[model samples]
Structures are given as structure tokens and as C-alpha cells.
Target: MERVVITGMGAVTPIGNDVKTYMDALKAGKCGVAPITHFDTAEFKVKVAAEIKDFDPTQYMDKREAKRMDSFCHYAVAAAAQALEQAGLREPGSFDPWRTGIIFGSGCGGLPIVETEVVRLHEKGPSRVSPLYIPEMIANMAAAHISMQFGIRGESVCPITACATSTHALGEAMRMIRHGYQDIVVAGGTEAAICTIGMAGFQNMKALYTGDDPQAASIPFDKRRSGFVMGEGAGALILESLSHAKARGAHIICEIAGYGATSDAYHITSPDPEGEGACRAMQLAIADAGLTPADVDYINAHGTSTPINEKYETIAIKKAFGDALKSVKVSSTKSMTGHMLGAAGAAEAIACAMAICDGIIPPTINFVEPDEDCDLDVCPNHAVQADVKVAISNSLGFGGHNATVLLKRYE
Candidate 1:
């Protein structure tokens, strides 16, 4: 197999819209959580979320074009534009259009649009629904729009595996490049589900934080931790074949070493009790990289700030690393960014790359009290400065999907 490397990254997160801003927030340990402003949440039990603030889609796209797309697609297009620009990929003429591809992931595709259309059809009439509803609401439309905007004629697909969506999408894109199926691929995830229906659904399931304090609302692995705070954002990475990048003298962020995906087959909405599936996924990723668990120096954990998730993830880490668990520096960026669901894995992967490149581990902020079961070092509160050689990112989704990707610092 050929090698794959990350050439560029872009993010439209709750904390920031660009890599520099996002990394700055991470270093400062800033929390992005705030009261829901997208819609009034007076009747909802969970009233807070990490919504992307001050986003004006018209700044990134034509106002008329933006009107036809959903928020998720808009976010994806903005992020993709940034990633392509950062990678020095200007137009289809710069590269073979047939050799360029787009693979994006979305856990809930155009949820806000779907909710709006449904409400319109019910309250008004079917004729009142916009004709662009279906195109904007489909999960694959994010990838489709990105392809159209960039004039990419290669494979375009969107993976919808809940929270693990982006991880799988990135991994699959990496595989395509490694196998010579594509020379370059824009891979990542986007999510903008911060709407009334989205918030109410998660609130009814008790999957969101009800804490009044935004700072303490997303304390992963802490005794005070409640549930995840809903977040909306998009993250995109430009993956190129090693030869292609080398030919262009691209700045390589890191090398994609391995990727592993699995399913618990045990639950629809919860992880396996023992975290066996998660453990296996990480272990397989390590093995696929031709490295032992001890070779991993850092982990961007899927710490969602949920009680059961935190416990099971801890168990999974211990099962995979054994005694090496103590040697690894683990962190949950979600503590500050909240849970972006499908976009999380890609965002976390970017965090891992940033950690490896900058030699500073992002902190799991607001981690005051720790559970006995979660005894591992979480690099709490403050960022930790360390030389990270190899890093792994974990993303476990609802419906038992678990995905892990291993990345090594570019030498």
C-alpha cells in the first residue's frame, strides 16, 4: 500500500472558524459553551449548547447559493474552501479532477432543515416547502456541494455512522489514497443540529447537559460531569498520496499510520459494558500501524462528558494499553468544545495532529473531581507540554460504531 499524509486542515467550530483561532482557544483552555441562541430553549430541559457564534454564511458563499443549502452543507463548504486554500489546491486545473475526491460525514444530515420543512408542511401546506429541501437535507449533500464547488469529479460519498462518522470517512479517504484510487481527498465531518427539534430530542433522551454553568457543563471524567453539551461545527482535512504531496512539496502535517473500525453489535445507543469493542478497535489500529500499544504517546479520547461513556472509555484504554496506560497522556477536547457528534472525530483528529506538531497536549478543562475508575492522567485543566511521537484518536458512535485512527509525527 502507498502512504497517506495530511496536507491541510480547516475548522468551523464553536470556539473558532479557523485553525489558528481554534488552536489558540485550546491553548487558553477556553470553553465555548453558552446559552442556546439559535432558538429559544425556555421549554427545553437542556438550555445550553456550544453553538457556532457569529457565523455568516454569506461571507463564504453567494447569498443565493447559501439559501439553497442547509446549515450543515454551508459549514462544510466553508471548511472545505479553507482546507483547499490551505493545501494550495486552487482549481480543477491544478490537479486531475477525476483523481480528486470528497468524503464527508454527518451524523444527522440537515436536521434543522428537515425539522423546518416538516413544520412548514404541517402548519402551512406541501406547496409551501422549498424545492431545495431534499437536496439540502440529504446526508451526502455536504460532499456533493463540496465536489461541485471545487469541480471535483472523483468519488464523492458521505458516511453516516453517528459520532464515528468523520473518523470512518477520513480513514476511508486515506485508504483510497493509499490504494491509488485517488491522488487527493477532502475528508472530514460537519454538523449543525443546534435547532429546536435537535435539542429537544437529545434532551428527552437525557443525553445533554442541564448544568447552568457553561464552564462546568462538560467536565469529562469528573465526578461532577453530567452529560454532553450539544455543539455545532465542521472540520475538514486534505489527505494526499505521499507521492502527490512530495511532488508538490506540500507541508505534511503527519502521516496516517493506521485505521481500524468496529461495531459493538451490543447496543443501538450505548457502548458495550466492558468497552470490548472500543478496545479492539484501538488495538487493531495499533497493530495495523505495526506498533505496540506502548508506542502510542497520546490519545485524543472520545470523552463525551457522559457518565457511562467516560467509564467505558477508561476501561477500553486500560484494556488496550495495560501498564502503558499510565505512560500515555490522554485528553478530551470536548470538555471545552462540547460534543459536535459526527464532526467530533475529525475535530479530535485535528487536535491530535496539532498536539503532535506543537508538542503540547490539549487539556480536558473543568476536570476537578475524578472518578476512581477514571484514574488515568487526563492532562486536566492546563495544557501539557510533551513530545508526542505517535497519537491515536478515538470516536465511538451511537449504534455500536467504534473507529480509531493512528497518526505519527512527520519526521
Candidate 2:
């Protein structure tokens, strides 16, 4: 079996447009939640979101090309370009294109595009709809765009598992490289659904934090926590075989040691209250990495600020770590970045890797009045520097999907 390592990472998040800025924002406890600017929310109860800041898609692609794709695809292409560039991979000729893969995914792809085209179809008839609508609106188009942009032609796949989408992508990418199916894989996720209809859907379902105060809205693990605030962004990582990376004289970021996935087999939108599935998922990941609960140093939890989610995830963690849970530091960058939905996992995965590299654990900002149900040392409201050797990121989705990916400081 081949060892899988991360060589590069990229992100287009609400807090920052690049990896360095994102890490800085995390360390500073910078909250990106603010009034929604994508559209007017005058009559809507939910007023704020973590919108991307000063994004210009043309910076990554030409005007004509950018016009053909949706915002989600644009984010995917930009992030992938940044990842490849950092990995010292410029063009198809630089590496073997046949042994490359892309696993970028989106939870609700091109929702804004569908909203626009549907309105056009209703007001101006079906003939007014743009011909590129279907292609740009599909979930798989993000991966397709990344593959085409970089001329990578092998094993392109886009996995959609709601919030777990990017975690699944990263896991599968590791498997592909570790099993010798691909020498390298671009894996991550993107989402741009903070539009009128998108907000309406989540808001109506009571899955959005409707408070007007941006700073106090996304208070993860806090007793006053409500629901998640919508966010838009993309995150990409270059996972390559350790041997392949060393042979090419690439800078190794860290090793993706293990991955585990499971399902609650319960409700469609809620996690198992007992957290049995989530506990097992973490157990499987630790075992797969040839490690134990005591070996984990930090946890980048899927803390969405939702009441039920935080409680259950806490329960799951307690079951997984047992006695070691007392000393382990845990946090949720969502308290700063809002919930990026499909892009959240990949961005959090990047957070874990950066934490290992810099020895700084990003804090769970906006935390106040901690919930008794969530009894853990969730590094609240402030970042701390620690020697982080092993970190795991968890992502649980709407369909009872749970995934855990473990990363180890590459020695």
C-alpha cells in the first residue's frame, strides 16, 4: 500500500479568499457572518450570511469562460488552480495526466443559476432560458470544470453527500492514490447557494439562524445556539502518493492517515440522538490509522451551532475518546466562517492541516454560556498554540451520513 500525503491546499472562503488569509482569520477569531449582500432580505427573517468578500472570477478565468459557468464552478476552478500552482504543477505536460483525478463536489450546485433561469422561464417563457443553464446548474459540473481547466483526464468523480460531500471526496481521493489507481488527486468542495431561494428554503425549514445580530448568531456549543448561518466558498487540496511526491521533490504538507464513513439509518435531516453511528465512524478512522483514542491531539468538530447537532456530536466524542476526552482540545471554525455547507468539510480539513503545521488550534468563536450537554474543552473564543501531532475532522450530513478523516503530522 502507498502512503497518501497532502502536497498543497487552496480555499475561497467567506473569511478569506486564500489559504494564508483563511488561517490568519481563524487564529484571530475573525467572524465572517454579516448582512446578506447577495440579495435583499428586507422581508425575510434570516438576515445575515457569510458571503464571499470582493470575489472577481475573472482573476481565475477569462470573461467569456466565466460567463458560461455558475458561481460554484467558478469557485472550484479558482481553488483548483491555486492548489495546482502551489504543488508546482502548472500544466498537463508537467505530470502524467492519465494518473490524475478530481473529486471536488458541491452540495447544492448552481442554485442561483436555477433560480435565475426558472424565473426567466416563468416570465419570458422557456425560450428565454440560457442554453448553458443545464450544464452550469448540475452538481457534477464543478468537478468537470476542474478537470477541464487543468487538463486532468483520469478518474474524475464528484461525490455528493450534503455536508459530508467534501470529506467523502477527500477520503476517496486518498484511497485512489493509496491504492495506486492515481498518482495525484484534487479533492475538495464548493458551494454558492446563499441566494434568495436558497436562503428561503433553509430558513423555511428552520435550519438557519434568523437573528439579526451577526456577531452572536453562530454560537457553536453555546447554550444560546440556534442554527447555522449560510456561507459560500470553495476548498481544494492536492493529495499525492508519498513516493510520487518525494520523487518530484514536492513539499509535503501532511499525511492523510485514515478515513471512515457510516450512516445513522435514522432521520433524513437529524443525526442519531445517541450518536452511535458518529462514534463508530471516529473509531473506524482511528483504527484505520493504526492509532488509538489517546493518540488524537485535536478535533476540528462539525459544530454547526445547531442545538441538537452539538449535543449529539458531544455525546459521540465522549463515546469515542472515553477518558482521553478530558484533555483533548476541540473547536469549530464554523463559529467564525459560518457553515459553508458542502465546502465546510474541505475548509475544516484545511484548518486541521494548518493547525498541525503551525501548532495553533483555531478557536470556536462566539461561544458564551456553554451548554452543560456539551461538556468538552471547546477552545472557546480564543486560539491557542499547541504541538498538534494528530488531528481529525468530522462532518455529518443531512442524510445521516457521517465521515471522519484523520491527518498526522508527517515525520
Candidate 3:
């Protein structure tokens, strides 16, 4: 198999717009959670979210172009542009466009646009609905828009596996590069679902944190954890074949060693009670990398700050690694960025790459009290500096969808 290496990364997260800003805020233990300002939350039970502050889409796109596309697509395009720039692939025409591809993920694609169109149709009749509604609301538009923007005609696709969307997208993109199907692929996830209907749906499901205090709202692995704090953003990474990267003298961030995906087939909204599915995914990723559990030094956990998820994920880690779990430094960057839904895994993957490159582990902030069931050493409160050779990022989405990606420090 051809080797796959990550050459670039870009993020438009709630905490920061770029990787440097994001990493700085994370290391400073800052929390992005605040009362929802995108829309009035007067009638909703959940009012807090980690929103992308001061993000003006017009900055990255023209007004006419921005009007036709939904916020989700705008985020995806902007992130992809950043990733491509960082990868030093500024001129798409210079490369074989046919051999490049795009695989972006979206869990709720253009949800706010759909909600708006639905209200317009009901209140102002069908004629009032925008003609671009269908194209804007589809889940695949993010990937489609990215392909169009970058002139990538090969294997344009989107993975919409709820929260696991981006992990699967990256994994699939890696597979394509590894199999000699593509030399370069723009892969990651984007989400902008912090609207009235989106918030109401998750609020009704009791999946959002309701704490009035922003700092205390997203306490993953803590005894006082209630639920995840919804966040909105996008993360994009540039994956290139190892030979292509070396030929271009591109700076390699890390190598995409293995990817594992599984389904619990157990529930629609909750993970497997025993974390069997998650354990299987991790084990598969480790085995695929030809590494033992002891080889993994850090884990960017799918710790959404929910009681059940934290408990079950802990069980899964213990089951997969046994005594090796004690030596692993696990942290939930979600504690700072909140949960980016479908984009969560992609954002966390960037954290993993950054960790391996900088030798610093981001912290799980606001971890006041530990849950008995979650007894692992969750690097809490502050970042830590340590030599990391290998790291794993895990994302578990609704419908029991689980995905894991193993990344190794570039030699």
C-alpha cells in the first residue's frame, strides 16, 4: 500500500479561526461556551453553545457567491482554501486535477437553510421559497462545492455519519491515496447547525448542556457532567501520497497509519452500553497500524461530556488496552471547543496532529470531579508536554457509528 501523509491542516473552530489561535486557546484552558447568540433562545431549554464569533463569510467569498451557498458550504470552502494554502497547493491548475479528490463530511448539512425554507413555504406560500434551497440543503453540497472550488474532479464524495462523518471521510480519503487512486485529497468535516430548529431538536433529545455558567457547562469525564455543549465550525486537512509530498518538499505533519470504522447496531441515539463497538474500532485501528496498545501514547477521546458516553468510552478504552490504559494520556479538546457535531472528529484529528508535532497534549478543561466509572487519567485543567510517537483520535456518532484514526509522528 502507498503511504499516506498529512501535509496541511486548517480549522475554523469556536475557540479560534486557525490552528495556531485554536491551539493557543486550548493550551490556555479557555472555554468557548457561551449563551447562544445566533438566534433568540427565549423559548428553548438549552441556550448555550460554542459559536464561531465574528465569522463573516463575505471575507472568504463574494457577496453574490455567499448568498447562493449555505453557511455550511461557506465554512467548508473557507476551510478547504486554508488547508490547500497551507499545503502549498495554491494553483490547482498546476497539478493533475483529475488525480485530486475531495471528501468532506456534514452531519446536518444546511439545516438552518432548510428550516428557513420550510418556514417560508408555510408562511409565504411555495413561491417565496428560494430556488437554490434544494441544492443548498443537500448533505453533499459541502463536498461538491469544495470539488468545484478546487477543480478536483476525482472521487468527490461526502460522508454523513452524524458525528463520525469527518473521521470516516478522512479515513476514506486516506484509503484512496494509499491505494494509488489519488495523489492528493482534501478531506475533513464542516458544520453550521447552531440555529433555532437545530438547537431545539438536540434540546428536546436532552443532548445539550444546560448550565448557565459557560465555564462549567462542558465538563467531560467529570461527575457533574450533564451533556455536551453544541458547537459550530469546520476543520479541513490536506492528505497527500508520501511520494508526492516528498517530491514537492512539503512539510509532513504526520502519517495516516490506520483507520477503523464500526457500527454498534445497538441504538439510534446512544452508544453501546458496554462500549463493545468502540473497543472494536480502537482495536482494529491499532492492529491495522501494526502496533500494540502500548505503542499509543495519547488519545483524543470522543468525550462529549455526557454521562453515558464518558462512562462507556472509559469502559471501551480499558477493554481495548487493558493495563496500557494507565499510561495513555487521554484528553477531550471538546472541553474547550465544545462538540462540533459532525465536524468534531475532524477538529480533534487536527489536535492529534498538532500534539504529535509540538509534543504538547491539549487539556480537558474544567475537570473538577472525576466520575467513578471514568477512572482513566484524563489530562485535566492544563496542557502537558510529552514526547508522543503515536496518537489515536476517536469519534462516535449517533446511530452507534464509530470511527478511529491512527496518526504517527513523521520521522
Candidate 4:
């Protein structure tokens, strides 16, 4: 089997537009949540979210081309461009187009476009709806547009596993490379669902924080935590075989050591109370990495700030790590970036790779009072400097999808 390594990463997040700026904000313990300015929230119960600021699609692509894509696709392409540029693959012939591929993921794609087109149809006729609506509203279009942008012909896959979408994409991409199917894969997740319907749906489900305080709304693992703050962004990564990266002299960030995925046949919206499926996912990932619980140093948890998610995730961690759970440092970047839906896993994976490279652990900001059930080293409210060698990122989605990816410091 071939070894998969991350060569480059790109992020268009609520806190920052690029990886460096985003990581800096993470290290600084910055909170990106704010009052929603994209739409009027006067009639809604939820008023705040971690929205991307000052993002001009024109900066990434021409206005004419930008108009055709939904905001989700724009974020995906922009992040992919940044990752490709960093990997030195923007130049023609830098890599074989047929040997490279793209695998992007999204939970809710082009919801804004769908909302607009439906309203247009209701007001006028079907003829008034934009002809580009179907193409722009589809979830797989993110991967399709990325493939067209870079001329990658190997395989363009779009996994729609809800919150685990991008984590599944990265895991499946590694499998493709290991199976000799592709040499390189541009994989990640993007989400832009901060529109009216998006907020109303989650709010109605009681899965979102309805508080007005931006800082207090997304307090993950805290006793007073209400719910997750909805967020929108994209995160992209360039994963290449170790030999390929070394042959091209690419700057390798970290090695993807192992990946594990499992389904909880328990519930559609709620995690298994015992965290059986999630625990097994982590155990499998650790076993696949050929490491014991003691070998793991850090965890980027699927701590969505919701009471159920945080509590169940804690049980999962304890069940998986056992004695080593006390030694490992855990943190949830969601406390800072809100919940980026499909993009959460990819963005947190980037943070894990960076943590290994820089020897710094990002903080779970807004964690004021710790819950007894969620007792672990959360790196609460402040970043920590540590020699992190092996890290695992966990993502659990709707429909009980659980995915874990173990990353190791590139040797």
C-alpha cells in the first residue's frame, strides 16, 4: 500500500480566508461568530453565526464566471486554487492531469440559489427561474467545477455524508491512492448554508444557538452551552503519495496514517447514547495507524457545542482511549469557527496538521465552565504549546456517520 501525505492546505473560513491567517486566528483564540449580515434575521430566533467576512468572489474569479456558481462552489474553487498554487501544481505539466483527481464534499450545496429560484418561481413563472439554477444547486457540481478548473480526469467524487462529508472524502481519497487508482487527489469540503431557510430549519430542530451573544453562543463542552452556531466556509487539501511528493520536492505538511469510518444504526439525528459507533471508529483508526492509545497526542473533536454532541463525544473518547484519554489534549475548533457543517472536518484536519508542524495546539475558545461529564484537557480558552506528534480528527454527521482520520508528523 502507498503512503498518503498532505502536501498543501487551503482554507476559506469564518475567521480567516487563507490557512496562515486562519491558523493565526486559531492560535490567538479568536471567535468569528457575529450577527448575520447576509440576511435579515429579525424574524428568526437565531441571530448570530460565524459568517465569512469581506469575502469577494471577484477576487478569486472573474465576475462573469462567479455569477454562474453558487457561493458554495465559489468557496470550493477558491480553496482548491489556493491549495494547488501552494503545491506548485498551478503550472501546466506540473503533474499528470489524468493521474490527479478531485474529491470535494458538501452537506448543503447551493441552498441560497435554491431558495432564490423557488421564490422567483412563486412570484413569476417557471420561465423566470435562472437556467443555471439546476447546475448551481447540485451538490456534486462542486467537484465537477473543480475538475474542470484543473483538468483532472482520474476521478471526481463528491461524498454527501452530511457533517462527515469531507472527512469521508479525504479517507476515500487515501484509499484511491493506496489502491493505485490515483497519485494525487485534491479533496475537502465546502458549505454555504447561512441563508434564511438554513437558519430556520436548524433553529426549528433546536440544533442551533438562539442566543444573541456571539461569544457565548458557541461555548463547546461548557456547562452553559446551548447549541452550535451555524457557519459557512470551505477547506481544501492536496494529498499525494509520499513518493510523488518527494519526487516533485513538494512541501509535505503531514502524513495521513490511517482512516476509519462506521455507521451507528441507532438514530438519524441523534448520536448513539453509548457512543458505540463513534468509539469503534476511533479504535479502528488507531489500530490502522499501528498505534496504541498511548501513541495519540491530540484530538480535534466533533464538539459542536450542542449538549448531546459534546456529551456523547466525550463518552466516545473515553471509551476509545481508556487510560490514555487523560494524557491526550482535546479541543474543538468549532467553538471558534462555529459549526462549518460539511467543511468542519477538513478545516479541523488542517489545524491538526499545522499543530504537528508548529508544536502548537489550537484552543477551544468560549469554554467558560466545564461540565463534569466532559472532563478532559480541552485546552480551554487558550492555545497551548506542545510537542504534538500524532493527532486524530473526528467527525460525526447526521444519520450516525462517524469518520476518523489519524495524522502523523512527516518524518
For all candidates, the clash counts are 0, 0, 0, 0
> Looking at candidate 3, what is the lDDT of residue 78?
82
lDDT of 2 by residue, 92-206 (tens): 5877999989998999999999999999999999999999999999999999988888899889998999999999999999989988999999999999999999999999999
In candidate 4, stretches whose alpha carbon ends up further than 4 angstroms from where it belongs are: none
Compose the digit string of candidate 4's lDDT tens values, residues 187-246. Answer: 999999999989999999999999899989898899999888998999999999999999
Residue ranges of candidate 1 with Cα displaced over 4 Å: none
Question: Best by lDDT, which number?
Answer: 2
Per-residue error (Å), model 2, residue 51: 0.4
lDDT of 1 at 202: 88
lDDT (tens digit, per residue) of candidate 3 on 19-106: 8888788778889998889998888888789999877777677888899998888888888888888899868565688888998989
Candidate 3 root-mean-square deviation in Å: 0.9
Whose TM-score is higher: candidate 2's or candidate 3's? 2
> How many pairs of residues collide in model 4?
0
Candidate 3 least-lDDT 10 residues: 89-98
Relative to the unseen true structure, what is the C-alpha lDDT of residue 76 in candidate 4, on a scale of 0 to 100?
93
Give the C-alpha lDDT of model 2: 0.93
**TM-score, prediction 3:** 0.99
lDDT of 1 by residue, 75-164 (tens): 898888888888889666877899999889899999999998999999999999999889989989999989888899999989999999
Clashing pairs in 1: none
